[model samples]
Target chain A: MIITPIDSTAPPEPTPTPTRTPTPPASSASVRRSRLGRTLEPFGFIAPTALLMLVLMIVPIVLVIGYSFTDNVILNKNPEFVGIENFVTVLTDGVFATAIGNTLVFTVVSVIAHLLIGLAFAMLLNSPLVSNASRAVFRVIYILPWLFTAAVIAVLWRMLLSPNGVVNYLLSSDLEWLSSPALALGAVTFINIWAGYPFFMVSLLAGLQGIPADLYEAATVDGANGVQRFFNVTLPQLRPIIISMTLLDLIWTSQQFALIWLTTGGGPINVTEMLSTFTYKLAFSRYEFALASTSAVLILLFSMVLAFFYVRHQRARD
Target chain B: MSKEAHGRRRTLRVLGASAAAVALFATAGCSASSDSGSGDGGDVTLEFAQWWEPELPDGAFRELMDEFEAENPGIKVELLSGPYASTKEQLFAGAAAGTMSDVVGLDGAWVSDFANQGAIADLTALMAESDYDDSELASQIQVDGATYMIPVVNFVYPMFTNDDLLAQAGVAAPPADRSEFAAAANAVAGLGDNTSGWILPLSLEAPNGIQNDVMSWVWATGGSMLDGGQPDVTNDEVTSAVEYIKGLWDEGAIAPGAFTMKEQDKVEEFTNGRVGMMIDSLAHINLIRETNPDLKFSISALPAEDGFDGERGIPYASWGIGVAESSEHPAEAWKLVDFLMSEETNAKLSSIANAFPGNTESVPDFVAEDELFATAFEIYQNGYPANEFTGLPVAEQLMRLFDEQFQVLLDGGQSVDEMLQKTQEAWLAEF
Candidate 1:
């Protein structure tokens, strides 16, 4: 996992061979020793993450993929292979389509909203007008979103957003916002943004803080205005974190089920049915495990394609 | 630090970390066995599963379980109740996949569904050996010409009326028929300020007290939730039932949150003097009285049509106990079921649970001797059995459709004829 951090970035920094060459004039044995140390250094750093990735991630994916092809009844009898049938059924179903559409809208809007707002907060937090103590306070405030468990976050949001809840209590309207198809997607997105933006804000703040003060200083010294300094230096410095966070958000928000499940249960007319909740309802609620498994495989395929594009784009950026 | 050595160290680190993680996960799977106490027969464990997580407050079931343990001496029964919504899903999965417990609770109505799936064991022979009359078990056990589930207790749905509230409206009896019930609702509703005539659950949601309250009315009018021998819901009888409900709505007998209130809310409102009356499961006698012991209420058959042959009310489906197919000790499991369901034990259990124990002896004693359950038992006897499949896969959808149309019909904004046509069309097409 850590080795990938150094992979294919900046074309080897356009090496000037002689100037950057290892100085080995002290002795051939010393040169050999340095070479050997260099060889082990990457592994020394990456071994832990690589090991975690294999056990915690790879093994499960392999198991699920193997199960996907089988009619694993899961309780009574041994599972046997049915092969691609689950996938085919899921793709053909209209409900899965609705779920996918809802998930896409939720993921895209929530991720972008969190990213832009987080960046804005990051910039404001970086301001000179805000004192260090208050900035620390704001940092603490930002953790509120991250601290709420998903179920609690959903319930809190539901009460605040219900027709009879505080949202309408403040607004003074009996509008069934959750049951309204026009507003349901936005309502869920609002929850995801509220519950998830703190992560982005915190990560962006850290990334922005890591930017060299000298570069901003240099730009300002060169008579670059505030906007120019931000565009030229701050933006470039935060690009890597922003792209990664967006990808992470895509994966996380797209899979939101608990919030929607608790709040609406895919409501008034299946208006808020996202893939994750739909799959759960199918597998458990209706006991359509085969169809549920098929939907899962479809989600896996869609996300893999998304991840592939993200990685390729990331590679291109590097 | 050569290339080979570097690779070897990385692999070793990965392997070491993986080994630790695997060990940690493997350790988490261990569970403490419940059957750990001293046993005269050296500890026999019976894993019992039910949808109820906590035992009902009624103490009868526990007493029965203790008696079973005493009778058998060494066998211990462990209770398992899962989360409400998906426990059945889990049970279905467990049954289909063949790892179910020693005994399970099956809804008497869905005996056929489970039986068809081969997920439940046939208990025909077991019933024959028991003291229970085999013919009476017909409603629960003989679905699709076969015996599948065994009844543990039977709960009948009855019309629960607030006697004081009824007197305030100058009425003698709650309601004897469809016409009188609607008239009574209007009159009694006049007693309380801004009060509606009834507090039936309008929502299809859980604890949807108002809706089920209304269903008794619908069924009493000779409508079935399902068409004859088919799941297709759209039909004239259903439409007539919907129309009758619309008429009640027109009379302004419904509560404001009736369409949306949780089930318990209906019962609670009536008990708290918030509503004139509520209709619900007769098993609620204990729980209802718990809220307000002084509150005056009576159980009666829901108002029937002018001259219907059958009793007007519905007997909410029965419950059954069955041994699992996988049990190594089927005899012990059946013995336990039979004992718990025996006349004496069932009577004791029924008293504690505040429900109709399946045993005829137990039921007669409770209904005939006990004051509390007498009215409810009479209602159960005269009432038609609520079908096992009344609420099926699309139950919520059916309830919502009924509420929506019922509301429209009452508001006089839509004709009952039109409402029924559209609603039934949508209903029948669903299945």
Candidate 2:
């Protein structure tokens, strides 16, 4: 009933908290007030985050989940609860199916490419012989995309890829980079991976450094090659991080719409509509709030599964 | 030891506060946003939310705003221009979240949608009570037979011709008949390397332009898009009009990259003296003229061939101002609307802004010398809006269908027969 995400895989903690932590003892009159303060200090320190999370994150999510059960059109003064109807409608809806298909395809493509390329780059950055200045320069260039606003990145990439835009000017011909349906989805996914890989690369580098060098040294002494060393020792060490990153990336990429929306507006026959874009179009453009919330809650439900896996993975690592 | 530790903590706290204060001060004194809140009585600031481009947050309109503030004792306007594509997105979010401004600017097409949703006000009674004239308003203000919008400036379609090309081609004047127009394309086909002979955008992506053009053809053939206030796209005239446009697509008379061209690209093709003929919005008249005032481009109506009256007129578009029904100050908003429609205010706005006058009484004088205005007025006088086919919000998918399928048909990706059937199917599904 407590619904800990890691009900089975959490194994067991070695011990619970020890009860006898030391407290500063004070004298007579002031002692009572200070003792009370001592008892409440931890609560006071935790209060801000607790309040923020409750109001900002928890309340909105609860409202969304609640709205998913109701009919909440634009002009409706009060929403009517119709239990399970929105969910049933979503399951039967063709548009929802198309969006989920598109979203999953985009997520898998972007995540796999990101992990492979990010791992390679992370290893390169972690090389002991790489110069500090060169490393700094590469880090700056890599992190730049993450620093840029998604809107700016979308717009910049749009300009680069427009038919008669800068890219065509450089090539001295109308390359038809964006207009053609053949290259359109690939173009968008490439931009996504380029804009996304640096975060994974930096994190992977940190994870790589945490893997003891002595393990790799032992593998090398056993006459394992460089690629073999990576697969045997490095792969085993990074499994938890990789799983967590995959789950995180899946959620993030599935929810990504601004880049696609700004770049293509889900055109060339709604080719770019992922789950998030479909929900946004329904909620805002179509004013079908009940339907949009249904889509959102569906995403939430899937995210809950990912969240459970993530928590279990993290706890196991602990 | 405890006192010293407390002293050290106090010093750290002061340092943190100092750093925070410095950061806050750094951002302060940058620009006092006029729309943050209603200042004291001496300075009333109003926030305006719109998606107009030239009227971007800090462009030509910014200087005008500074001037408005300079003259009015305490009245300041903060302009919030959102992205053009996402205005509808912002408007609906405004409806749901209750974040709309006191004044709203939207396409006249949307007045009814917003009015029905209880998001916009009933300007009918407001106008009746005031000195507002209904004739000055745009033609599309009525939604479900209710008058509910304030007509701002309009951007009606008027055909533009390269007079120099027509003269050289021995066409005495721009064609006034559709048969003659088609013949004109044949004659002008190989005029020169620099000449494309004729140009109309294939995209219809900006459907208003295409709607205007198609309606001209429909009217030319004595047909309307609606009969008894319903869509009638299957009619003989509508069918012929579609085929006639398809014929032009077949003739290869349009610019090659017309499908991919944006608004500016279309204008540049015409303005660079490449296109022999072009059709565009009346609002873009200044833009065309500004490119090269010396260019002998002229404005005219779309030629007619099959009208019962032996001629037809362009279909029109209009822009308008509307107050949110949720506005806190409806009375004040109405006052602003009345002021905007007043002859004095109209003249002031028209002189400063490139906006056409909305007052019917004064528009004649305004357009007396300007031939472009004369042509647009002629179009507006005779123009009609095609049936919306679907409701405005729902019509997005329908319009997208028209745009997308037109591209498909133009590219020969589908036969005309298939295009017709598919278009009907798409519209029926959306409608």
Candidate 3:
């Protein structure tokens, strides 16, 4: 028997022995129908979700946009289109300007603080110096604030920060944390940060664990100090997660209405007024639904800009 | 196609069709469930949406509805109850969608807006059509000469003073005038251990604080926030009241968190003996009594200015009721309204709610039994029930706008003149 070695890259020679009848190609109409079925198949699977989104989200958005151009809709039996009048009114209003400024400060500060605190906690939890049992305990404790709903968080913080509440008793100072024009905005923001940081912490914790040990070891071998290793290796490794979480937090925090509403109610004197509260007051409190719609549309556009960046970042990462 | 590919495609198509059917059925099911009481039946079921059921004593409102159902053989009433805020939101949403309940619990403040939008039926027309006697009704909220709402029960705002605190400060009685109120407030503050003279809740969230507390001062002096149904917030009486309140704020006589405090907080402060006084609703009398049984308190007419000598204006809020314009059974809804407004039912409801009856011919029995109610009744008889915000367009918004400026005034961020001026402008814009 002759042992032959086949060239691996070469095409195999075809061996022919048996004969078979040829199958005829189908008619053009059947082929077209099959192609159409393939195309329509995925849509069928998603039809329910698509229908729900249309009814719940897209329809409301379109209606609100339409309303922004009208005069006192919902309350008016026959609202006439005013075309940008509501937009002008909302833009020129001083309260809307104040709401915009406050929303920006609240969003920017919350996102930055959430990132820093979340990263710090994630790193601490990820540390090998800690026991697994201790980490698990701390993780639950850290995540406790996030477990509460907005209403619960608002009520809890209100009780805790009242003039004669435990916070005051502990500090031995009678500060009106949720009432003072100077303090209310900062107070609500702190509560939001507390309630929100756990999301980032959990996400970054998983990201931290996923980073290979070799990068840190390499940095350590290359004369990198702990801080240097963190800046050079850990932070860079966590950058994508940081960006994604930051954008998400920005979106969530900017739209925070329930906490502010349940707490200071955007007052002493509009000190804590966010765009969400401003729009709500116009529609519900003031019954100026058209004006509210205008404000809402503006907020939607702003959110879409943030969402654009988020989507772009996500795509690039993918 | 291969047999496997053909099978896969068939499976996908079946799954898609099933999903579409499920979605369609879900939507249809929701629509059917939402139209529950509107179904065709031998008996008509009227959906009554209200916050009043929760406010009434447990099973009291339900008993009243049972009585109505018993009296009318072919009619049934279904309650949709919630807190005031949630109820208001639901009613507004329903109104916008033209799906409001057959009968609605309305705030007097909401009548003008609801009527303007044609969301509520014109009671004047309903009354005429049914030949319902409107003479016995105490008052009707009207817009454009058409009645849109009628008060079912009235809750007057009276001055509530913590007797123990007043005694501790050597104050002999509840203040009868603004000057006395100021002096007594200061005295109470001077004897303080974190205790303030008064709790003035001016929260913009629910700025009835302005209507019930701040404006009650002006109203108590027979001053009106309106002149011929127009904004008159910068009038002398309103200015004087604002000045008086500002004086208290400057002297630290008002509660610490007045800007953010709500009606509930005001009641809480008075109940806990943390504050000496508050202008509070009669609706809260039972609540205060229940929350702090040992807290001694007295009710009085909101104090007038030093030298004013006219019949005082007593600020009052009402549990106003209306029929939805979109109600299919408008006649049946009117019957329920008429039943609720009857002399016997009105008296019974007022007694249960600790409020005054809306029927001119009826008096709540509690007025005879409860001393506080007797005092309130005498006060009500002597003074006119005044609330200019009621029946005004965007009344709550007016209160909130005034609240914002008044808050600024209290914080010393603006003068009383500026506050009134700005508030006047805001009010005029709404008008």
Task: Decide which is better by DockQ, 1 or 2.
Answer: 1
lDDT of 2 by residue, B153-233 (tens): 555556778887777777778776677777666556567554666665433223443454454577645566555654455
Q: Candidate 2: deviation at residue B4, Å? A: 8.8
Local accuracy of candidate 1 as per-residue lDDT tens digits, A78-154: 66789888777777877678887888888998999999888988888988799999999998887788898888986
True contacts kept of each: 0.01, 0.07, 0.74
Docking class of 3: medium
How far off is residue A266 in model 1, in Å? Answer: 1.0
User: Which stretches of candidate 2 lie above 4 Å from their native place?
Assistant: A1-41, A121-148, A156-175, A205-218, A233-241, B1-94, B97-100, B131-133, B138-140, B159-224, B244-279, B285-300, B303-317, B327-329, B364-397, B404-431
Q: Which candidate do you rate higher for TM-score, 1 or 2?
A: 2
Instruction: List DockQ for all candidates.
Output: 0.11, 0.10, 0.49
Write candidate 3's Cα lDDT for B1-431 as tens digits.
57777677687788887988899888767668455555466788999999999887899999999999999988999999999999999999988989899999999888888887789999999999999989999889899899999999999988889999999999999999988999999999998688999888877787889888888888899888888889988899889888888888899898887778888888887899888999888888888999989999999988999988999998999999999999999999999999999999999999899899899888999999989989999998888889888898888888889988888887779888888988899888888
Instruction: Report the lDDT of model 1 for residue A300.
Output: 89
Residues A122-214 of candidate 2: C-alpha lDDT, one tens digit per residue: 889888888889988888877788888788997688668765467777887765554455565777788899889988898898899899989
